[model samples]
Target chain A: MPYVTVKMLEGRTEEQKRDLCEKVTKAVSETTGAPEENVVVFIEEMSKNHYAVAGKRFSDQ
Target chain B: MPYVTVKMLEGRTEEQKRDLCEKVTKAVSETTGAPEENVVVFIEEMSKNHYAVAGKRFSDQ
Candidate 1:
């Protein structure tokens, strides 16, 4: 029942996302003792404008 | 790194998100002893079709 989410900037290819989901599911399942089939992975992509650091938006920098 | 994410249906206004970020940052900073500036919060919005529960997507229901 472990749901893992990977958040990063948008632009990865579909193949890379597929590989990431597979690898992350396997790693999470192995480490947390959850079944591979039960591990859920979510990918979140953020545009530069919506991201920030040190009180400054990425788009401003 | 205590990176916090809020995933939900995509309908909220920008003001609500701003409020959420502020409250979440304060709460996390207070509980985890991390400075407010160091606590990063990410908002993830999903359409109905992208969300699922009990193996059925919300759009299908």
Candidate 2:
């Protein structure tokens, strides 16, 4: 089985996430020769405060 | 700043995940020319049953 995970900042529309999942699953299946039935995709959304960059939190960015 | 998130199956050792986070952060920093201090990485583990592909759950795969 081929499992894929995507992590991004919170706030994208559900439609965007759905599209991303579908596209990523398709791409991984094609690239890895994994069965479409064996491809699993998961998404995680990080809050602005929980994420940071350049010594500042995402909320500050 | 760049924030990176990784989602994967729940069984990887903490050390493995740490390595992956480091490698991915490095890769993104190099490719995007983002500073190392600007990179933030988060990992989320999905239970096998919480992820699926085609018509089957990852646990079934």
TM-score of each model, in listed order: 0.57, 0.53
DockQ list for all candidates: 0.20, 0.17
Residue lDDT tens for model 2, B1-61: 5767567778876556556666777788889998878787766668999998898998887
Q: Compose the digit string of candidate 2's lDDT tens values, residues A1-61.
A: 6878787788999899989988898898889888888899889777655454543445544
Show model 2 residue runs off by greater than 4 Å: B1-38, B41-61
* Candidate 1 chain B weakest lDDT stretch, 10 residues: B13-22
Model 1 per-residue lDDT tens digits across residues A1-61: 8988888989999999999999999999989999999999999889754554433335555
- Report the C-alpha lDDT of model 1 over B6-59, residue by residue, as the tens digit: 788999876576667668778888889987778777777889999999999999
Q: Which ten residues in a row have the lowest lDDT in candidate 2 chain B?
A: B13-22
How big is the positional error of residue B30 in model 2, measured in Å on the Cα after superposition? Answer: 18
